[model samples]
Target: MAAEKSLHEYDVILVGAGISGINFAYRLQERNPELSFCILEGRHELGGTWSLFKYPGIRSDSDLYTFGFPWRPWEEQNSIAQGARIINYMKESAAMYGIDKKIQYHHQVNNANYSTSSKRWTLDVTANGSEQRAFRCKFFLMCTGYYDYKEPLKAIIPGIEDFEGTVAHPQFWPEDMDYTDKNVVIVGSGATAITLLPNLAPKASHVTILQRSPSYVMSQPSEDKLELLIRRMTWWSKPLEHRLIRWKWLLVPFLFTRFAYTFPKTCRKLFGKAIQAQLPPTLPRDPHFNPSYDPFEQRVCFCPDGDFYECLRSGKGSVQTGVIEKVTPHGIKLTSGDELHPDIIVTATGLKVRFAGGMKLSIDDKPYNVAEKFIWKGVMLEDLPNAAFVIGYVDASWTLGADATAQLMCRMMKQMRKEHVVEVVPRRSEAEKRTMTEEPLLRLTSTYVRKAKDMLPKAGSSGQWKARSYYYKDIWMAWFGDIRSGLEWVRGV
Candidate 1:
């Protein structure tokens, strides 16, 4: 009863106080200052993944210029920054914009029921994992990230329990745990595993990266040379230099991705040569660096200043490619009959993809499975009313798409206010739904994505219904495009 009295209400309820949530709040505040909104965060703090993951070498795989919010330029010299720096940046943004005051920490939304008649959402929120309270909002903005934060997806190799040493996942790295002068084996070859290599290699006695298959890996410097040159020149102002650098960062990746898709063989050869140039002369370039798939089929792992290669070259780390037979008391046994005797094992296996942060949803008291719905313009769902979710670009920096979605949502809200519309929903025609190509929402070929294909929404053939990965096109379509197309407008419903 006391919890019921504590029930809150707002014009809009934003779930998750992460990067996307912060961006949305800023944009919405800038556009419509009269709107009253509150952000609900499940954790005790903000920063989302940056604050949650405290692994040895946690860092941003994408450059900061594109990954950062477009409204606020990342002024740091390092494009690929460490996790602590990112967390700090997010905190600074929240503080500077006074967004921190609007966030209710430790309030996790357990369920949401949207009533069409009232055109409002009633959320059952669990506070501090015990007290239950209700919240009502006119509109819902889901800024919850794509993956499950509670648990990481760990492959169950045989006899993992038999290992006597400490086995950990990067998602839940213990703060007090020490790995100095110990043999470490990290499982998986994704960005997390690659990031951990260089950082742990220097401290640990030896670090071995075990992968079932290789991922396309590339290395670039932490600082952008072009950006540095622009900064050095006095001809341009700071704003102009920032825009130039941001566009350069954005276009380079976009063009490279297109080139990889257009001429995969040539890009693959170039990728191999780049890897070979950094590797030690004794190590063969065939199985170690060469992956079975084409470049850009999956996201490429970027190492800052070739730190991973330098660590390997220094004889502190090594890479082994094979299937895991089982885990023994001492270490992991490979299918090729090779046994790795390590004191500590870090499972850097992928994340468990969760939609809408695993919040149960119902529209007009009817159950709704988000996976069964289709994505409209990569922002809102096909039939969801007064709600939008932020899903970023899979091919490029996530914030590029996230920023675009935020801007689009703000625009739609403004339009709705002006039109006196009580409810807005994207509706797919029966013909469009029946004839639409039921492709996986994500276009990447990563293992985690493949595993979560069925859990994700479907993409349509073309036009507004299609899920696009290109930031350039999404910027024009989502930011500048009309909001009336494919949307059903209800006036004072």
Candidate 2:
């Protein structure tokens, strides 16, 4: 093992050296090898999302063909991979790139205060057994990920807390917790519910899904021939290949998403028919399970390990398509007067998203407010100087955008250094133009919406800037666009 150094700080201070943070570090280092930096990660190891969440059947919902990195071919042939496999890949990347040494394990940064006078940031981080230490640096980059830490959750069920049975959240299931032979009730119908029910089916005596509303579930081939073909072609311009793929998907869903938003019922019928064909003909009819929504409105869940749909074919479990009225001491009571008693309850209700809340950046004695910032090209946050955040793709594999953000950040940094500049931000007018141009795709409200609110660059007075939401357009703007021609470094220019 390389001897770890405890220098006061580096030229850059990165939060969460997961995929985004680690990639950013490498990109910056590649641009300026003389640059010194350190990454502060909350988890004991790397692999941000992959390492933190350890629930059963945990794997990426997105396909690996598009989500996986360009340089390294996914060792796994499958389109989607298991959680453990992905986490290991992350660790492997760190080792391959010598990034592990730059990482400070157990260093959890609570907040950062930026000093314009000194051109540094004082980071308050917890490390070495919760002892808080402050580190100062010239620049701050946050990639802590969007999801908040696991906390106690609440349900709408009446008298639910009184239940004598064990309660667990799929988000933070204990390492030693056992589900075998227990009757479990999974509440909520998002990705977690879709995944948990099947994994618990074999061990649990009975598993019932209680939900208020059902998300549209769409299935795709576990593998894509086009993606396989393209994986070989990624070595070319990363931006070029991404554009080809983005527009390729746009052809099918381009009209569907627009039609769904304009004429909701028509699009819903298209999805309903698809669901009906896959479901059992003899099962009872329930709209909660079969909704009238666009296929990809919310991300669809897939069981890569086993047949996800097969869980329904067998009698091991059932889906209760009704709203939960309340929770009694024993179990959950539905609004339809159906009471489900169980030995354990798992809450898979979706996650709570707080835009800009996760990142606390204080600059020049003033807090950098996300609400006031406009999203530029769906990447950089406005009003922030020498700072960037790498967000994984919501609908696509995070690595798809993860790779793009890394490349673009490095390119911009190189340009800044060459031109001699201290800070750079998107012009408000340009950001507004981009946002307004793509409001339909960039509606500032999806699970990925908070990112736009916090980081989207500001545009013009119209307040409708077009943010290039697609990966291809963003790469061009970030890499090729001459927007930064106006920027002249305050020091040397």
Candidate 3:
């Protein structure tokens, strides 16, 4: 007979150990100190994207004040921080809260089975790509982020194999590789490509950013002047100064989004002027800086202190806009019949967005398709019992949504324990389903989001069933609102 598998039990199983995971764990332990919880990390270490991505000039696209957790004030002067600093910050947060001790590294959850009868989840986790283990938990919280770990969204160009040059993806950048004096061409005009231009240009023989279409690009200082001023004020306490700076930075993004949506033409003019002001007089602002879509429709790329533009102006970098016809032994050939030669090509293409960390989910041995379900307030899925997944905002800093979701999850779990309930599920009535409209979970117009829309959950038309992206609205609903909305509390099964 085969040996029986040992099952470890816990009150909650928090997935990923990234920013969302650490934040959620911190909130749970802070609110309910007696609750037993463990964090499951797929990778050997923490830091999520910050740790995973080691590409040139990898940094948070959003300002650090908003990107950092609300509980922890970012003391760094640079609003746009390097990847290593962010990773250390996350490590420090985990260590300070004792969250690192609770993390089980290399424990990647492959499948989760929920039993309605027992009101428990049986997780099949693979330890370091082998050695399967079983973990039973009363509540499951998935903070695996929005993208796939193993695969990135790489475009299949014709004759890609014909290229003799070194090709790489930004997602899994080779650590030992060096491009000190080699000519480099980075594909895709998204955040990665934009960031790589300035950083690589200084060292590389020449750096060229090739894109099929343009994306909105703006420049801002690395440091926040207002935060610097606040920090310098000796009369103000550190905590008070931090809170004020955080709120101030938070309002900027919110207002920017509001203005863009409310007055598209006006915002477009303002954005166009900003781009033109940054670029040199020789570089035409038409096709290079001006994007096809309106502002805020897609994410705007930020270049700290016009670093990208400075590289271009200084003749160290260039931008090319054309469709890729094929890749030659020398370099890339454009559809417009323009041939360019480069020593190295980097595919800075977008991520492959995956929901629930691509883990197979089943309810009582029946396979459950999460895409068919409706999202409840962007946290819980309709009719999904004792589980919540973090889906952050596309418009603003992701941590804002993450913090809100964590607060809500803690509140709901506490309410369940207080009421002596074994299960708390957000179920939509048949009438509610018929009356409510369905929409994609993510509203962003980015390529990655568009590709993954079919695989993600849907949002309802109104009430608690709808998923919201606004941080201000979420603050009220998740932080201070009642947990009874659209949730069913049941006694012991």
Candidate 4:
């Protein structure tokens, strides 16, 4: 007979050890200390995205002030931080809070099933390599982020197999591979491609960014002088100074996002002028710098202190706007009769969206289809019991949204215990469902988001079902908003 699998029990089971997971862990410890929980991480180590992405010049586009957790202020002088530094910060924070000890690395949750009768979640997880383990919990939290780690979004580059040169994806950048003096061409105009241009340009013989369309690229300083001055003020306490600086970053981006949405034309002109000022005079701002879409329609890419533009000025890097006709053995041929001869090709295309870490979810024997469900206040999913997932903002710092979700999750858990409730789920009445039209969960019109539209959860027109992006609104909702709007609470199992 086969050996029986050992079952471990907990009050809550959190998946993934990324920023969202760590923040949630901290909040849980602070607010719901009585409840027992452990984080199940699939990788050998923590740091999720920061740890996984090993690409050259891997850094955050958002300033560290907002990106860093609210509980722990990023003390570094620079706002935009390198991946290694970010990883170190996360590791240090985890260790400081004793959250690292709660993490069980190499535990990949394959499937999760909720029993309505028992009011518990049973997860089928693979520990280490092939050892099977069972973990049961009252609550399940997925912090796996929105994208797939195993596979990147496959770009449709014709004749890619025919290319004789090396092709690399930013998601899994080869560590030992050297690009020394080889010509490189990076595909896609997203943040990843924009970041790679300046980073690879210095060492490569030449680096060219090949994009079918343009995106808004803005330059900001890595370190804020005003923030530095504020830090020097002896009158203000350390925490007070940090709070003030954080608020400045938070409000500035919030206002700017609203402004972009409200006045697209004005923002466009401002962005165009800024781009023209940094770029070389000879380079035309029309085809390469000009985007058909309005500002923040898609995410605006940021380069610290005009590094991307500086590379262009130095002639070490350049941008080409055209459709890829095909990939030759030697290089890429464009539809516009232009050809790029590069020794290395980097497909910085995009990431593939994977909900709940691509784990199979079910309720009592029925399969849970995420695409058919509507998100509740961007936290819980409709009909998904005692569970929540964290999704961050596309326009602002991701930590702001993650922290809001964490606070809301902790509050809900506390309320559940206070009210003596065994289970809670977001429920939509049939009447309400009839009036609600489905919208995309992700607000962005980017290629990856568009491709995964049908695969993601649905959003409602308004009320508790709308997919939220504004950090101020989300934080307020977490702290003071009513949690019982559409949520159903059960007294006993």
lDDT (CA) per prediction: 0.88, 0.65, 0.88, 0.92
Alpha-carbon error at 209 in model 2, in Å? 1.5
Error of 1 at 398 (Å): 1.1
How do all models score by TM-score? 0.97, 0.83, 0.97, 0.98
Q: Per-residue lDDT for 333-424 in model 2, tens only?
A: 77789888888988776555443326467777677776566554456666666666666654555765666776776776666677766566
Could you tell me the lDDT of residue 444 within candidate 1?
Answer: 83
Give lDDT for model 1. Answer: 0.88
Candidate 3 residue lDDT tens string, 1-493: 1113568799999999898999999999888777899999999899999989999889889988889988788987778999999999999989988999999999989899999888899998888787888899999999999899899986888887889989989999999879999999998999899899999988899999999999988898876677677778834587877787788888987998999999999999999998888787778888887888889788888888889899989989989999999998998999999988999999988999898789999999899898898988899887889999997888888898999999988888887888789998988877887898987677778888888877888888887877686999898887788678688989774
Across 126-224, the per-residue lDDT of candidate 4 in tens digits comes to: 999899899999999999999999999999999999999899999999998799999999999999999999999888999999999999999989767
If the candidates were sorted by their lDDT against the true structure, best first, what order would they fall in?
A: 4, 1, 3, 2
Write candidate 1's Cα lDDT for 1-493 as tens digits: 8756877889999999999999999988999788999999999999999999999879998999888878888987788999999989899988998999999999999999999888999999999999888999988999999999997886878899999999989999988878999999999999999999999988899999999999888998987677678778835588887888888898888899999999999999999999999888777787878998998778899999999999989999999999999999998999899999999999999999998899999998898888788888888887889999998877788888788888888888888899899899999877786777876688888888988877777788865788776877777875678788778999983
Name the lDDT value of residue 228 in candidate 4: 74
**Candidate 3 lDDT for residue 224:** 64
TM-score quality measure for candidate 1 = 0.97
**RMSD in order of candidates:** 1.4, 5.3, 1.5, 1.3
Compared with the true structure, the alpha-carbon lDDT of candidate 3 equals: 0.88
Which candidate do you rate higher for lDDT, 2 or 4? 4
